[model samples]
Target chain A: MKKYNAVFACLLLVLFTNSAAASSSLEEYFYASGKIKVVITVAAIVLIGLFVYLQRLDSRLKKLEKNKIEK
Target chain B: MKLWLKILCAVLLFYALLSSFYHPLAPGGLTVDIEKLVPGANTFVYSGYNTHFKDHSNDGLQFFVSSGSHYYPTEIIEVIDNNHAKVNVVLPDTLPSEEIAFYANTPTDGTVYIMKPMDISAFVFHQNYTNGSVPVKVANDQHQNFGYPFQVIIFESIRNLMWHVPMWFTMFVIMFISFIQSIHVLSATGRENMLDSSMIYVQSGIHDRKASASAETGLIFCILGLITGSIWARFTWGAWWTNDPQLNGAMVVFLMYVAYFILRNSVNDEEKRARLAAIFNIFAFVLLVVLLMVMPRFAEGLHPGKSGNPAFSSYDLDSSLRMVFYPAVFGFILLGYWIYNLRLRIKILESNEEI
Candidate 1:
């Protein structure tokens, strides 16, 4: 839950902060033939975020298991 | 299956159905029967009648009008007739003679027939004969009229219905489940784990302070619903909001449920919160159904799916659109279910330990 909340917070920050900037940056980032640094940064964040979410889920499941054992 | 997966599948199906049945109005196609608007280049005569829905008009001309939610229309061609036969010349804005030349986008099978040699062969032949003319040699050199197919791009924002509305539905369904569980906890104490009642009602295990899965998801869904709805309204209705009773009623319903969430959060006692929240959920859902289903019948809105609106009926629903839109709604609902389940599981995990 903490991890989900953190990810949510990060998403709100990155996305809402950039709604006005999307037309230019998103076009540059996702345009079929466009070349720019924004695309690379967006790609990196997605990969890193996915990694973190999975890690958090794994840890949460483990914590649940540990509690179950002690109980 | 995961709830999100089901919702995804449903949404994809809905879009596929819609796309299959609903086609954008294209220009230069054989219009079943519509008045064509022609431009003037020295000559000033409209080749069709003036009407919103009919007049055998020429194709390829675009008009900009502020209709509904759109601030500036992309482009619209006026239609005024229905007969596939010959048409009239609307004056003040059309070419003078049948031999007038013009350009447009690629022509389709159904686009207006340009007044050319084929369309004017009889008129010219009659004039030549009246002038004591010998049979003129057939001249077939020019084809200035290229058909610009009629292209109408509708707002695909109907796609958001799958994403936003389902969130609320799923929220309600989950909240209903929570409501049921809370009642069970309150009613059956012998083996139902009385200490964990708070998970079903107010907060989580010891200090998580997380309300029921239904409440949080419901709130999120409500927010998303408003944002997407406003966007759709801007594109379709020409305004973010109108005096439509259905819209107002829905807003009221949403606010009521949001208040329910606030109410649940305000009261801290485990026993009082669970019982009260459960009761509130029941009332809120009942009101939601009433507003969505009943209020629309009495009051008119820019929304199409109501009874009196011809726009939302079979006329608008072509076989093409059914392919996509149907599945999308289902997919969204399924995804909502998935989210609810995941949240419920998380709550259970949090509550399992007595710490």
Candidate 2:
């Protein structure tokens, strides 16, 4: 859990810096074409978040099944 | 839970995803370049978001300026392009009302109008000025196209409705399941007939596991809903986070549920933990209702439906939107249930292994 927290913190730092660097262009890109890119960005976030959550759950279940076999 | 239901959920989601992006937006007024209308001839460019002015230029394209009940016709100088037109309207020296509105009518795009406050101090205002002498042809035909209503700031981002709204709905359904399971956990302890205390403990333990599993799933959805809503708010409402009552309420609900998990984990004894967490869950659910449902209605906020009896106005959930939104809601709720089911099975297995 501590390892996961560290990884997430690092990921957030990278994302924040990257966004800060290209904030102007990113805002322009999202606002252009009647702000359709905003919708795409939201959809991408939902899809990726759900996938990541499912992957974590799958790994945890795998660990539990392995422990049961060992016992 | 059932194979058929899972397939139906998949199909509904697919349909929602397809239709949400596939449908076009109805033509609406975008902007009029003129700042103020003077007494003499006023020529300004009119731009539309999704309209065909060029195609209908020679056809039935007409423009009008309306003041109160009187309509004054405007001459179309030129159709610049499909979405642009230069219009010239001559206003009378004495006007009935200073409140002026511009209207554009086309064969394909129907009628789109823009109302802007004009600097009408230059023109003398007469209450009984007869400006209705000229016979003006106003096309009352609605836009024939079947599409989502085109909102100004929320143009294509309106599509986010299908994705963002369903997350909260799904969270509500999952949390309700968690609430019901928590009630079972509390009630199981009240039975007097059970001679074996171990039996009650086992039964309540199963309910506790189910409750926690569903709550976990509900929390995931709640987070998703918050993120999506925040993103939507940024572009439309000009901020990622607003002090809107609904928004603050949602944030509090999220924190409260996080507290629920912390409370569950802190207690070591199984029976005591279940009993305490169940009571806390009941309180959390009640708080959720008051914060999200009851309070938002009374307070004025940026979110629509606040200060209004219904959650959404008729214009917000038009027939075209309903076609896609209903399926999206059902799909997400089923998906939440499916996730909760899987999580509950895992929790039950883990608890059994502990025994």
Judged by TM-score, which candidate is best? Answer: 2
In the order shown, what is each candidate's alpha-carbon RMSD? Answer: 13.1, 2.4
DockQ scores for all predicted structures: 0.09, 0.76
On a 0 to 100 scale, what is the lDDT of residue B284 in model 1? 73
Query: Which docking class does model 1 fall in?
Result: incorrect
Model 1, span B36-96: residue lDDT tens: 3332111212132111123323543322111111111122233334322332232222122
Clashing pairs in model 2, backbone N/Cα/C closer than 3 A: none
lDDT of 2 by residue, B1-355 (tens): 9999999999998987887688787787788998877887999998887888999988988888888767788899999998899999988888887678788888887788888766777788788996643556665436665577777778888888888899989988899989999999999987737658889988898999999999999999999999999989988898889999989999999999999999998999989999999999999999998998889888989876666533433654347567778999999899889988988898888787887
- Give stretches of model 2 more than 4 Å off: A1-15, A18-25, B132-141, B308-313, B316-318
- TM-scores for every candidate against the unseen true structure: 0.51, 0.93
Which model scores highest in DockQ?
A: 2
Give the number of the best model, judged by lDDT. 2
Looking at candidate 1, what TM-score does chain B attain?
0.54
Q: Write the per-residue lDDT of candidate 1 for residues A1-71, one digit (tens) a residue.
A: 77678877987788667656665664334332212132233223323543553465467678888877887
